[model samples]
Target chain A: MRIPLSITDNIQEWLVSMMSESAASYVAMIIVALIYLGIFAIAGLFLVLIERRVAAWFQLRIGPNRVGFQGLLQTMADALKLVSKELTGTDRADKFLYNLAPYFVIISALMALGVMPFTKEFQAFDINIGIFFLIAISSIGVIGILLGGWASNNKFALIGAMRSGVQTISYELSVGLSLLTMILLTGSLQLSEIVEVQKGGWLIVQGHIPAIIAFMIYMIAGTAETNRAPFDMVEAESELGAGFHTEYSGMKFAYFFLAEFINMFLIAAIAATVFFGAWLSPFGITESIPWLGVFWFLAKTLVLVFLMMWFRWTFPRLRVDQLLTLEWKYLLPINLVNIVIMAFIVWQKLIIQI
Target chain B: MGYFSNIFNGIKTLLTGMSITGKYFLNSRKGAITQQYPDNRETLKMFDRFRGEVIMPHDENNEHACTGCQKCEIACPNGTIEIIWDRGIDEETGKKKKKIDQFVYHLSMCTMCGLCIDVCPTDAIEWGQNFENSVYDRTALTRVLNEPESKVRAGIED
Candidate 1:
């Protein structure tokens, strides 16, 4: 299933019941790490395949189809090829961070799953300020990307990494402001509690127009934060070869690639949680049926992922100046205003009568 | 004042931009551009002119019209073709002749130059639609002729 933390919870529960309660926490952490690696491998394969198909449709062209059924196994074949390929290091490249960056990026993204709520009952830590924790961890991923770019000793790599670092930091403000509105509405920052509140009716419906506006802002800022197109100045193929990780090879390169897709899913899942109401859909309508909420949660996330793919394929990459303008001049100010209005609404009850 | 105007303009722009995505999202039906390729390959039509693999044409008696002319090989810059020849004696005329043992065209190496067919004086070859030539073995690209030796002899006799 697409659920990340539920499996971790299941492991924790089994360990607690079978073994001592204290040791159960240790078992749970280990299980979460295994799941982190397992999910990253599987999801990266699926993301690559989906991206090719989505690009194909947008451009009215056929994508890879000969390797497996509709090229479903194409990424696995690519992974195999990558494993066998020899890694070439630049003669002048820094040996340490060049090797360390990919693992750092992957681990930082994996840390995000620790706070992400997959279902009502499943969360690793379920910190009261889970949304803030998620943002903080995702931001660390940019550091790894930046290190990889700088360590590569290539001009393009350095440029890509620096661009990525700046873009991520700037867009984070807008993303944070958008989520702050939801925090104001729910009044509690715990992810499970937020999902529980949405059980009666989703935040999208209950919070109404403001929630949707926040969602739109979140999407724009989130896309930019992840270094996804059209804000993908770091990986601009025309100007830069492979961007920040250009000098990386073998599983190290694969790790960086995995981190990107996982980060994409993280943003999509968190967006679904905060703004689209986590795993809730119209109470009794979905609650009566077992596993319906999980299905709806996944369906929502996949739709968001498809929208991301459409965006990457259809739009041209933005200039660095224009990209920052979009954030500072447009998204940041709008979100700032949105937060103020939302806070005002909560305090004064300015929401229109039904 | 300028800052507020900027913020206000942003909200308008964001809404206008979101409305476009939301409108399409709300209006979209099934067939969300997900094409199941193999299932749909029956309806797949490439224009008659796509330069894929080259094929040698065989007559009703299975005689290929190629006379082992090296013009196509000379014209090609990539050296994708290597026309192998086998010397043989005609049974009916007691005359020695040079025949193609293999008109080996490496599909991977081919740049789809179509010069091979154009240079063939006998109209013996043309581009074919069978593009499913990808394989694990690189050597599988050398296509053996469908034309029988008897038919080739008949053509020589004619």
Candidate 2:
């Protein structure tokens, strides 16, 4: 018997076959949500492990290797430790908002993960406004940081949160504009449709010069948006003493930590999907085997993730003023000009076709 | 003109920084400077002159080099070494010789300065390389350098 390639489709069919239509849909939604949650947790943990290992390597040291074979279970152990820790709060903190903050950050990141096309048909929610949804959802994560910082009733936390608000707002422009440049090439807002357009050739290859610039700008902005190092004004440990989540302890702290890694993965995944061909095998070598698309997608995403990790380890954190200068002075201007270039290229039918 | 040049130079410097780290990352297997202690105990070797602790070397005959000399005790800055000695007749020489009843070493007070080893007139004491000195009880840090019932080596001039 030939194995079905689309596991999601097969699962959907099985669910429908076994239950009433409405019930099947409900069951499918529940199952998909559960699966995405599992993925979010596992991916966050795995990315943290990867970041630690990569950071260690760059610093000429061995990272965690004693927990489980090459420290595979280190993050798992950390998660357990975090869960068992006492949830502490400041004496005079805003109780309601402080308690409510981490969920906002974590839920926003989890929602963004729903639309990622891991393979041809593996996406949980393949909404038509996929890119827009991601952009909108990702921006909501800033609210969590702001709330966490404000409700903590600490000066440093407030400063960090305010810096984050400023940084995210500024970089958000470059991120949208750069992705907007690519959108001009694909002429579609749908992520899968964007990937389908790349079947002729990857967007980066087709729209070579401008697309490369957009990719670079997108990477910079995306890294900033995630509040990662070099752009981690949100949690500038030296300046803000753990920043927005300073008052958070135990599982609440873990939620913020996990969400950061998830956001990094989201940024890299978006870069992988939009710039590189999402789940499309390079040169159609693995085209016959549709299942291999998942492998390719993950491999591409991991490469971008490693790039982000590289940036984190190599670059020092930007000063608050310098951060804004970079966004407004360099990235914004370049992104604006690149979008126009991309538009001109599209108008002249100058895109490279395979 | 300079505006664009500044951007280019900035990116170039950033790339240079990345290349340096990237080089180390690629060569990390051979370049990692961390030594996994305990796990690598069998292979780990301290330097020859590392002042881990003061020790008295004894032979197969249970004879040591120390002759109850107070030089180490006197040389120790913090009085980490203490010698309780008794005058005993040497059978071969038929003379009174100072022999240690207990050669106590307070490792807690010892700074590992090698002063005690340097000042031992009979070349009795030397540095030991066993540095895992932690103990639950404070009294456990006080060590007896000479083995119980051990005698001084024969044919050594005081």
By DockQ, the best candidate is: 2
Error of 2 at A121 (Å): 1.0
lDDT of 2 by residue, A113-167 (tens): 8889998778777778889999999999999999999999999889889998999
Residue pairs in collision within model 1: none
Q: Which stretches of candidate 2 lie over 4 Å from their true place?
A: A1-23, B47-106, B110-129, B136-158
- TM-score of predicted structure 1, chain A: 0.92
RMSD of 2: 5.0
- Candidate 2: tens digits of C-alpha lDDT, residues B53-143: 8888998999998877688888888989889899999898899878889999999999988877777777888888887889999999999
Q: Count of backbone clashes for each model? A: 0, 0
Model 1 spans with C-alpha error above 4 angstroms:
A1-20, A350-354, B1-158
Q: Over all chains combined, what TM-score does candidate 1 have? A: 0.71
Please compute DockQ, using alpha carbons, for every candidate against the native two-chain complex. Answer: 0.06, 0.64
lDDT of each: 0.77, 0.90
TM-score of chain A of each: 0.92, 0.96
Can you write out model 1's per-residue Cα lDDT over B1-158, one digit (the tens) per residue? Answer: 69768668856875666455555444433424445657878876555997778887776666776767667778777987777777888686899987777777767678897887888776777888875678888778766543546235256324
